[model samples]
Target chain A: MTNETASAYPGVSALVHKHLPKVPFTADKTLTDANITVEPAHFLELMQGLKERRELAFDYLRNVVGIDMQDEGLVCKYQLHSMKHRHSIQVTVHTPPGNPHIPSLTGLYAAADWHEREAAEMLGLVFDGHPNLKNLLLDEDVRIHPLLKAHPLQKMEIAQGIEDRDPGFKF
Target chain B: MTVWPEERLVTADAFNTVDMTINVGPQHPATHGVFRMVLTVDGEMVVDCEPYIGYLHRGLEKLTENHDYRQSMGWWDRTDYLAGMACEMAYCMAVEKLGQFEVPERAEYIRVMMVELSRILSHLMFFGAFGADVGSFGTSFIYAWRERERIYDFFEEVSGDRMFPTYFRPGGVQMDLPENYEDRVRWLLGSIRQGLEDFDGLLTGNEIFVERCRGLSPVSQEQAVDWGLGGACLRSTGLAYDIRKVEPYSVYDRLKFDIPVGKTGDVFDRFIVRMAEAWQSTKIIEQCLDQMPKGLVLNPDLPKTLRIDSGECYIRTEGTKGEYGVYAMAKGGNKPYRMKLRSPSFCNLSALKQMVVGHYVADAIIILGSLDIVLGEVDK
Candidate 1:
């Protein structure tokens, strides 16, 4: 953390803006905690810079979550925290409808391995370079994406013994 | 000296060893819960290990998505069953953050007290189970149980349940503390301190136990961060980065306590760190008791049902295991659109294959025990 950054401890989003001038991302200021977007193509380059750069060294990858955005796409969120500076930020990357492939962070952060596996199994988002992205919390052979908005909660494919290709469910 | 031909050397008999695959248990005792691992050993030294979890998976995230905001509290309590109250605090904090609800000052202090108590409860379990893992038999477990039962009795008085006390609410707590809570908690603190001394004498001070665990599976600070280990596992690597201290939530910022760290990041360091942490938790609870105010425990201004319009936030707490975090996104409804739990056990357990590969098979169990994973949280 620099002198100006240390003095202004909570201006993490400002520091992020200063560091990545070329990348196009927005910061949320209401909670003073921001959500920055990353293009699928430039995700790895930006993440590498964030981890290696001293001012924005988000070395700790706290959590990764996969969210289904219906018509928009599937979203992969990376929650990063810097132990040195004691600041944190969330980075979101979106992939379109059937093209749910995002670059994997397993190589950068070993913590991303199981998290990516869980997200891939639950939301049907494919991690491009994940070494062993298999089903984590679900049955290994079951081909089901349970967390999608379109998936029925009450009548999941695994719940009832009857293996219907489609079941009637209304929310 | 007897001389032999060069050809004789080739026909000489030699000792041979085969790599044997051993299954440790989706049901065995040392596993702590329904966790299974396959260890391939080459003459007592483990060459490879593969851990299989999710035997206890209950689809917590999917279940949380389906239920109403308030109704979902019970399920999170089951995630880290050893420290259910701590889990409740994290869940409630996320909900409160999303809806912009105000928790009372008195409730904040009470919540801190309960969470700290849960921390101690969880740590005591580690001391007991880890001791058994390193070979102290049933004595330490019984010693831990005595203090745990007393704490559970107190929890029963407060929340009417021993293990899964769903006592926390979104804005505050489910109810006020009993009239004699401070006095009772103070008495319980004395017993806990005494219990700690016993564990110190029994396990930490034991020469055999120390020798067995001292330098086993040492992890560097860089390796630990990359592996995403947290709580005592991360602190043992000598980083003073605790969510309570670094990123203060609830009343942790107001209360003063030191984050204990270890220099070597060894198995013994992890054990000693949690022991010291239990002592710190006692201090936090005492502080909370002294400074706590008297007011409504639950927020009186909340409506019959909560309906969040739009919000997104990740609430992280220093849970008994590690950073028990909840990432909640409320698109607009009485229920959250999605709530994902970043459970520490799941992350820590993922690094097991790296930690256990080169050690003796027996030491692998000890290392796994030191990680102190609650499979409920891991499989969720």
Candidate 2:
């Protein structure tokens, strides 16, 4: 691990290093909270270790956000808090340009169910093993990922037209 | 051959019934604000539940990403419309954290006062609406509105609009409190306390309301934390883990108040916790009034157009409902690269399926109401 990453949250970094020394983890600096960036390959194992470790019991999955980096790839961020320790950390997972797949945390945290679905529907990040990864906060039939940077913000009339459905009878 | 009325004896298998699906609200009043849930029932007991949202999703995050930092304040307030100021505070705090803006000391106290008042406003709404769900109907709603209107009047006097004030800026509030506001708020508190007493007599003191909610859907502290429940719902389970107390934000550290926890995390516990929390909010406001210093409300060093080189922060505040968190990332621009609201109502509502699965159909509605979910936040 880099010095900057270790310095962000020294206690958590020390704990992560002691438990999962083999995992290739790097630190990302943020204005607030300890953030660590990891690849999709090591995502699940690292998360499991974080939760199972007695001293670093990050049991509560606070928030999940998916960001689209046009050139790099899609990013999935998970904010976790240990109710026991009251310390929080942000986990960042990046998938290559076309592959937006990451392991789901639904098994470990029940809170991941809706959050993963929301992330999936919003930015099209696929969470493998999420039981019902259907469209959330969107129509069941709608397949578009509105949050992707490629998707333009259109006017209401133009957006309605793009859907290619019937504009019901006018009065 | 047809059996006579008393001749045939009824066996357990004789009355076999098929499971039925009942759809409640994209419009129903009990579901509360454009939320819909499909419940599969074995007679009266709900076997399964699937909630449908997004009818009100206006792409809040998308809108925030598109607009300037200050321009998006209007949309954030609408998330928890019942407590608009509380949502604004979270949004502003996130912006301030990312930009490293210093808010005037007076503004912090004012922001805390308004947010606490907003919390009371939200809890009163829950009290009224939950009372209606428990069969009190219009009486409780009217009683809640009596205090709510008085509070709204104060809000309107401070800011032009009542519901979505959009009064908080990144560095501070849009403007200072109105002159003579302290006297008005003191009078309002007296009226609000009386309103709480009336609700106590009408709902809490009533045996029917007590018995109906007492043992319903009890949640353990571990279960609450595992399910990511927050606010009164999590506290009802005896966790005593309030964001305000555990992680003090704004002026909460200076204030003196008690976090009311419940013995059993049931519907009744959720109700009582919120009631006690509302009472505590009044105390915090009174403290703000006593300790508030005279100074500028907005930061003097703020630029006309705020810009940050690059920074990211997840700021969490004790929203009226729960932990209202904002994960903000700014990358060399007036607008943030990404802003995500970890709305309390959304997280609290996510565990509805587990909470409502084994309860009666009527009781499921009560469970949903007890969660005190504002759909605007959930769908956003």
Candidate 3:
């Protein structure tokens, strides 16, 4: 971990790699300076550790999002920031096609509870160990996560085509 | 603070009290939107609570995947309906970051003024709702919205729409501040000050209002820090962390205002912090107007459609509630590979479980009100 090459961008990404090892952590050229990507397993450890540390405390759990990676399935991302350092980092864990599960970070950051639940219901990622995991943004009667690529909209019969529905029927 | 030892004091058979689960929204005005809360209660004490959202979720995330970046501006308005401008700012910042575009100085100043105005507006709604929660009745609620109407007038003049002001874009604002904007804003600011002073006498000093909120729903400094509460919610806990000062996005660093703090981490403190913040926001707008640069609003060099080629960026700012952040990933395309919003209400609402666990059932609504959540932001 310590033997890896140092990050060239010594601003936000510097603090990021400084705390985590070089196993799956890698940087991609993005808008601001750099976009640091880490493995899901390593991400959980890095974030949990970041929450505990005093000097490098990434105390604020800023945002959680679920993104469809097309062929790669869904990638659940967490954007974490530090109130003290004025820096930010993006951590992502990929869920496999169809069924997906990741260890919940609600234990570490309580904010992750609803986010994980939303992601679970929206993109179909099972957040194991979430104290009260349930469908947040969708009804049980309405099946399928609309955000998922594999979920067939036509088959679900939720959103009818413009041609299929008669508006004037008023039923 | 009594720290109970880690032990199960009540067994399943010993529990004679069963919590009555009450579903409180998807229709109730207090739920704030098409959202519902499942409150499990024994008499007036709440045993458990769960928030149900997505009644208004129109699959905007999926819709964005089909539309261009410019079209996505409309969705930001729907996310945080009250603080639409802040959402627009965050979205614009993310797009600007992704495209490596810059907004003109005049645009930046106008943007700052607009966001500050929106911040005041959101806080007004918070104060009104919080007052309503505690039976303060139409007095604070009416006064807050009445003052908010002036700001909406300014919004209507600037952008054709009053509520959903989709007045921001990647390169800059949708357009410059309207003609005679300085006069209107100045008048609005003066009106807000007078309204605030009247509000002070009518609601702030009222004995009943103060007593209901002073110590109820108290949050310790460590608890606030641990829970990741921000904006006025965090300030009520005695921490003076304002992203405008700390991170200093846009032209905020150029301006000056004190980030108000409270000594006591209670509902009263939260109210006090927000009231002071409305004044601070007014001060910010005054400064922006005084020294607002005269130039183009949008960056002339940027192209029509944002083509963010192979990059990702997370741009954030202190919205009315807290840290409103946007994460954008572009893979050499016009449309974003993925766009994610890290909403403030979502983070603020996270503290509800801890805050209400030990308090009475009535305090649950007060705590939720103190958190100042917008369901659109929460569900997003």
Candidate 4:
């Protein structure tokens, strides 16, 4: 948040927000040199660009986590570092109240696999391209997201109807 | 590679070249405590290896959500049972940072002493396990464990639990060091040094250990960095970067110690790095003891329930294994709506398959041993 910390990693904001306008669903942008905040859609491309460019080369995907904001929904936050550039940035993908989904960054970072699995299991966020989409740190049959503000009871008969009615199911 | 003369072992026929599939535990000795690895093998050489975790997953993350901030300290102790004090310290620092609580100088010194002592104990386990993996078996392991027991005694005396010491609180340690603690720790320091000397004679210079370890599983520095390796694993790759040095959390900036590195990132280099680090940890404990102060162990300013004033912060600290982080978001509520743990072993273990690719099956155990993963922390 301080100027010194911001200036410590110079030009990070420009590098992150270069392709920001192209992406849909972006929120308020904090273009500090140390950190940047972009919407979830922009986050995927920003990570992709960071990986390809030799100047950026943010190869190490350290952590991906989901945070529950009450009244609001889940926020998927990612921390990335370029060991080559000696810089770090945080990206957040905010999801609204009822349904939370974010583009899976596992293709960009293999370490994102287990982390995405953890987030999906904990917050019920469906990652579009995760290789293994099963539960992590919880039983497979768990019907509720533990980290949510409301402890969603199974209401078995009704919940099953909603799950079955999901239009994405081709079968 | 010459094939064995037996036609049944060497044949292309399915009936002759029968490769038995074995599930080598949620309880195998080499799987390292409740970790199940389904191995498909062809006569002692592994064709495929699939690691299955969660045998020790007691849902600590979900369980912590139900408890208060103070109550969560007990759960942190159980996560990394080997480096229990480090786990306690990391979680405590997260809560303190969130609440803006300041620890007394005395408590800092005690924590430094206790954590360094635990670091030595953990490295000893690494040594013992590495030796056992390299086929020295009980000879070196029992010797390392023998010295480690004395350090456990000191932990028990202070924290009241030998294995999992829930001694660190939000702002400081649970209690002051017990009477005559200095004498006991000093004695341990000497005894552990002597034990290291004996351990060196048993395993370090021996031809078998040298041959099995020297050139096997050599991870390039770029690969290590790409995989997010930390602690001794990163140190062994000539990085010379330690979280204790770069990040400077706790009293690490004030303390003086060398970050040992290796020329070639092999199993032997890892062993050397850990051995040298044990001596460095001893040096740190001595300094912490010398600069020991007298004050309150817990901060009186810290509230019983932590309700940080409307914000989110991600705090990271150097655990004995690597960077153990706690990400806490407070909506000014008594319990956190979200808490994410960034465990080091999970990242380090992600690199396991890559490290073992070209190496023989025998060398895989040694490679994993060098990584020094605690499965509980890895799965959690």
Candidate 5:
């Protein structure tokens, strides 16, 4: 983790550092927001502290993005904003190569319902406590994760078994 | 009247009312696009609403991931089809941030002006559509089209296309504004003010419209923030959290504008807030015209084929509908490693079930209309 990136809200990082000393956070060089990487085991606990702690007060769940990190594993990235402090942070959670289970934020933030579903369907990350873990932007019965790096763009038809013929190129 | 048999006589309690399910639009006009919702109605009141989207799902993110940085601009504009320029601004800003490119002063002003115009265009569409939803039908739509057509004409003069004007490049705009663009936009603004007054008198002053929308589906600030509502929807809840004002990206900090807020955050508040916001957008455009410099629109130093060594950034802009945020990441490639759109319409639409339940079936439709969701943005 690099300390070179300056935070837009220095107070936010200071507050986090003071409160949760164990949780390591790095300032994102490209963006102003602070970025934290947490394991699936401590993900819920860290998120709860980020929300419940009055100083942190990350009330808004801005976005959830699922990335297929190829050999590393599947990653779920969350952007959270504190409406009170007007500060935002990005949380990255990595799951094991085969085990893509992350605790759901639906119980904590109401906005997580659809975001979790979208992430779940797009990258095949299982949100453990998500009430409805169905496909959002994809078909209900379509079980393929389209956003994975392994999933070829042009060969979607062939992959889905819609066409028997082989399209030549592969990404 | 002849008396019926005692056993045949019906009592209110004796009637068995099974909740009827009403499926509205994957094709219907009222849905605004290809969005469908199944409402479980116990009589007139909606017990539950299950909104099913993705009908217009084009795998925008997946497509962006596969394509080069510049190649994905067209798709981003299509995400918010109504305000294509606004979406383009967000997309360009994201790419620019990832590459750490500097836009020219004149270009920034031009970009702001176009985005504000797009905002008005989008809000005007909402005005017309919401009026139609409230039973005014074609009258309001035609009123909206009058101004929209003029704006589109201006847009066409500036850019080649009317709707998806891919006018914005990563570092700046495609080109400078047309020579007579200033005079034309000034006249357009005057006409827009008149159009706004027409809407105000037609809808805002109408007693029936007010009665229908007032006190319907009131959302608190907490609810708005919790459910991830943005733009007019969140502002109507009285939070005054406009990204343009709060974050002040591009030239927004240099310009001056007011963030309109509602008292109760009800359906009427949402409508009125958007009306006021449209007026505010006009103010912004006027300022941009005044402050614009004379220089190159596109940065000269930008590479022909844009490539980033390694970086990640989440760029948030005040979209016409809400907070249009783009999360971009590049790891030593010409194509972005991952590009995720934190689209406001999608978030606003997610809370539909919570807001619709307990409202009358007709009111439920009104509530959905209040959200002002573009299905393109929602299902991106």
Candidate 6:
């Protein structure tokens, strides 16, 4: 990275450095701007700090993206912005192989309710404390995570279920 | 002895009054496009609301992940269908920032002009629809439609399509403005200003419309921020936060325009904030047209296929609705690994339950209308 590019997100990096020294998060530069990876165990603590800290008040939960890494595990990415300070950060939590569970942020940020549901339904990453984690944009009865790498793009072949037939969408 | 029904009270469980659940829209006009909500009402007042979105979901992120960067442009425009060019600008800015490409100065100015026009277009839609919500019926819709049709004709003259023009590319625009485009746009601006004046006389000047919206659903600034409301919703809380003024992307830093804010953050404040913003957008367009340089519209050094070795970033723009943000991750490929949109309507719509729980059923409809959510953006 160039000097200019590396120095862009100083607020995020500085906030992470000053507040969370022992939380097992490294300020990885190669990832997206303000990328911080934490274990599922320390995820809630770190996230609560990020939202509650006065100087680094990351209040608004923007988007939640869930990814399936196949061999590694399932991962959830959270984009947060502070309306007060106008700084942004991305928090990445990687779950274990068999256990794809992470604590939900619906309590901390009310905006996380729908976003967490979308992430859960898309990639099958289970949010632990979410009140409603049922299908959001997909069929209410359909039980599948189509955005996973293993799921094929809909082709000429008919997929598994009966409700998978068309879904009656209008323009 | 005679007893009055108004003073009569039932003890414990005699002749119990049950809470009734009513479903509004998936087809109804009041709920806007394809959105459904189940309202649990106790008599006339709503006690709970469960919003069911996704009727308009097209899996935009999944499709964008599979296609090349340029191929995803058409799909993003459909997200905020009312403001296609605004969505285009956000998508292109994300791609350009990811690839570290340079956009020409002339292209920047043109992009701003088109986006501000889109802002006006979307705000006009709110005025028309919100007026219909508050019982103006066909009058306000027709008044707003007149100006929209003129703007659409101008857009067709430039891009050959009325909606979803897909006119923006990674580095800049698909093409330059046509001959005498300035004269035509200036005429359109005159027409837009006239339309605004008529709307002001019709709705804002009317006593009933202001009376209906003045004190409905008043929101505190802290509550608005916590609920993640954006665009007019946030500004209506008397907070002077606008992405254009706060985080000056593109050529907005060079231009000057005031951020219109509300005093009480009620339904009336939300309505007027957008109305005042329409005037500011006009000012922005005038400045952009005057200062635009004469040069190439597209970058000369762009690659045939955009490929980032490995880079990712979040690009945000002040979309007509709010902070329309795109988070793009490209890891050594032409296709994006993950592309997520933080749509303003989706975040703003999530606050419906909190906003609608205590109001009367009729007032609840007006409150939802005041939110002005596009289902396309919400479901995406």
Q: Which candidate wins on lDDT? A: 5
Model 4 stretches with alpha carbons more than 4 Å out: A1-35, A97-99, A139-144, A152-171, B1-20
Which one wins on DockQ?
5
RMSD of 6: 3.6
Candidate 2 vs candidate 5: the DockQ winner is: 5
Please give, for residues B1-380, the per-residue lDDT of candidate 4 as tens digits: 98777755734555556675668677767766776665566777666666666667765666666667887788787777788898888777766766667888889889878888888888898888888888989987899899889899888899889989888887888888888888777878899899888888888889988988888778788777777787788778887866676657778888999889997788888889889988999999988878887778888887666776554556667777777777666556666555677888777776776676555667777787888888878766
Docking class of 3: acceptable
Chain B vs. true chain B: TM-score per candidate: 0.97, 0.97, 0.93, 0.92, 0.98, 0.97
**B184-269, model 3: which lDDT tens digit per residue?**
88988999999889878877998988887888878877777667787888888888788787667889878989999998789889
**Model 6 whole-model lDDT (C-alpha atoms):** 0.86
- lDDT over C-alpha atoms for residue B71 of model 6: 96
Tens digit of per-residue lDDT, candidate 6, span B167-210? 88988898999999987788788889999999999999999999
Model 4 has an lDDT value of 0.74
Better of 5 and 6 by DockQ: 5
- Least accurate stretch of 10 residues (summed lDDT) in model 5 chain A? A1-10
> Distance (Å) between predicted and true CA of B251, model 1?
0.9
TM-score of chain B of 6: 0.97
How high is the DockQ of candidate 6? 0.44
Candidate 3 C-alpha lDDT tens digits along A22-135: 546666534443456666567667777667766567777767778778788678777666767655555667767765777888888766777787787777677878887677
Candidate 1, residue B164: Cα displacement in angstroms equals 0.5
CA displacement after TM-score superposition, residue B53 of candidate 1 (Å):
1.1
| Candidate achieving higher lDDT, 2 or 6 | 2
Task: Please write out the lDDT profile of model 2 over residues B267-322, one tens digit for every residue.
Answer: 99999999999999999999999999998999979998989888888888899899
Q: Fraction of reference contacts reproduced per prediction?
A: 0.51, 0.66, 0.53, 0.22, 0.61, 0.54
Question: What C-alpha lDDT do the candidate models reach, one value each?
Answer: 0.88, 0.89, 0.77, 0.74, 0.90, 0.86
Candidate 3 vs 6: which has more DockQ: 6
lDDT (Cα, tens digit) per residue for candidate 4, span A117-156:
8888777888887888887556566555655545433333
Residue-wise C-alpha lDDT for candidate 1, range A1-171, written one tens digit per residue: 000112333377678778877766765532324567878988888888788889999999999999998999899988888888777888889898899999999889998999999999999999999999888887788777889988877644434446755465422
